[model samples]
Target: MAENLEPTPVDETSNRINTPFNRRNFLKYTGLTMAATAIVLTGCDDDDDDTTPMAEGSVNLGTGDVGILNYAYALEQLEAAFYTQVVANAAFSTAFPSALERSILTDIRNHEVAHREFFKAAIPAASRIPDLTPDFSAVNFSSRASVLATAKTFEDLGVAAYNGAGKLFTDTGNGLTYLTLAGKIVSVEARHAAEIRDLISNGDFAKGDSGIIAGRQIVDTNGLDVALMPLEVLQRAQPFIKQTIVATGLPTQ
Candidate 1:
């Protein structure tokens, strides 16, 4: 049986200074409630597709559109967990002394949590993947550079994952809904990637020769963002994830 992966509530009273842009404000300002309500109203009509059987210990991400949603859900779970830990760490204040930086990070945490919940509501319970455990041992949360670098990795990966997975949705009835939602969310992730890059270096947001975003290899010669297959994305993400995710039944072409 899979564990029900509920979003962990972020602690309001922490060592860091309180910010006005909390999760509630995020939902209200972004109209996330209405969006989620719409998903809930229309997300369950599609039936679950047949999934390939997985190894006994590994988790199967399901098949068809559900697999893609599960894949997104798994990634969101990781991002939300990472940001939650970043804001809650004992050295959070010392690592990021700038109030603006702290506020921005907090807002990102809120956005990620909302994204996680949105997928949870969008995918039917029977098709949703289990809560994944993250392995952040490689990350030195106390160090500013370490935290920012990890944030860059996550944000960039998220954008690329959505870009890569968008074409795989084949369900004519609900595919558009998922694709539109993905577009909206990926835009936010791209913003986060840009913000983190700028924070790392004043003008490193989208700098590259002839349009490619340098350093991360996430952009191409045509100025388009890199799109990776599910297996490839999972391979890059596996280090942060403890669970062995078997991404079967996802479209290859």
Candidate 2:
């Protein structure tokens, strides 16, 4: 029987549940995106003519499962950076009226903070993949529409990432453990996705009504989809991720 599960609130101190996830083991975005995008753009232009390059050694996140864990750690870092900026510079204008909006975003920030810290704690060795720098200049932090749209994109991407990466850790020692952890976070991510989408248009929330959902093709998976290749994920995430990723022992899905 598929057990009924209540989604854990990011703001709550506990997620004590009777499903695969509970506070005990399982635990844990984006206007943050334009802000991040700006940082990346500026950083790229800063070093105009440094040709001297040093030999860069691969930061081994270990083989098999270890590598997978590190992969997640890298992603968490990106999410954390984006949300941190959103929280740091939350701009509510007169047009956007909702005290609840700020509160909800704060909850999201806390969750992202927890996810980032969790990965850092779980994989100490891989945590050194360089702190990611974000660019938010493109966003008029003064506008609520820009912030929520960017937030929605990030929330959806995060869910897709987990859905796409869940199978890669299949043979590792803590494979099941990691999957459960992913499951826990994926639910929260999905909620964020829905909320942001609703904020855009409740009728279009998680659907194809809005241009964002209908325009872009999305393949949905309950974490049972084919695992995305490391190379592919890296490519999509490259623009936002400035860190060097060294991966090994990842299986083809």
Candidate 3:
């Protein structure tokens, strides 16, 4: 029998910072509750997948609406896996040595998992991407600096990805549900990024405005957040995951 892949209960205390907009607001606005779940982590090895691994080391994300949904799915899977591993490892406690940090990380983990599950359920099973194995060998979770730095990276990347992908949902005869949903999630990601940034360096939120690269930077000159095409986001993320991602039918413009 296949094992159940539900999220294990989180016992740590999580203090939701005072913010008018947050996950609570997100749920209220999106009509989402904390009841549903998300993605699973596959093996880190190349042979881990039940389906044939990608040829030439590249997995093609599907095209059009499904393609767009799958793209978000992939990122959420990565984030969920990274946080899951981070909190589970003994090193996390030793590294941060703060109850608040651990609690916040756990909260982030649960949120990412829900996001992952949302995408998995949103897209048809026929078009869904396989569970991905993340490569975190370079993360050095034992070190507080390393872990926070990586958290910063993933959070910022997520913000940029949603910013870029949002355009794909614009007025293409499709209803605004997906677009609205994307907006809701991106705001959450922005919050996560800000929190992580403050943990790393005070006032380090969205450096894109201070003359950083266009898509790679977290925010732009207009105080707008960064955006990256799917290919660009995937390329930047490739190093973190063992599986190679191929964007065959995703929109480019």
lDDT (C-alpha, whole model) for all candidates: 0.74, 0.52, 0.67
Order of models, best TM-score first: 1, 3, 2
Candidates in order: C-alpha RMSD to true structure: 6.7, 12.9, 9.3
User: What does the lDDT read for residue 177 in candidate 3?
Assistant: 54
lDDT by residue (1-253, candidate 1, tens digit) is 2111224434444311112234564454345566554654365435663332355546788887788888998898889888888887889999999988988888788778778767766777667776666778899999999999899888888988999999987645543467777888899999998999899989888654322234555565788987777887888889987668888678776
**TM-score of every model?**
0.81, 0.64, 0.76
Which candidate achieves the best TM-score against the true structure? 1
Question: Per-residue lDDT tens digits of candidate 2, residues 1-253?
Answer: 2111223332222211111222322242222222322332222222222211112623334445555656666666666556545544535424246757766765776566666655544443322343444444455556778878778767766776777677765533322356666777777787877777888776555564333234443433452322346656665555654334545445547
Most accurate candidate by lDDT: 1
TM-score of predicted structure 3? 0.76
Candidate that beats the other on lDDT, 1 or 3, i.e. the better one: 1
Winner on TM-score between 1 and 2 is 1
What is the TM-score of candidate 2?
0.64
Q: List clashing residue pairs in candidate 2.
A: 30-33, 34-136, 35-135, 35-136, 36-134, 36-135, 36-136, 37-135, 38-135, 39-135
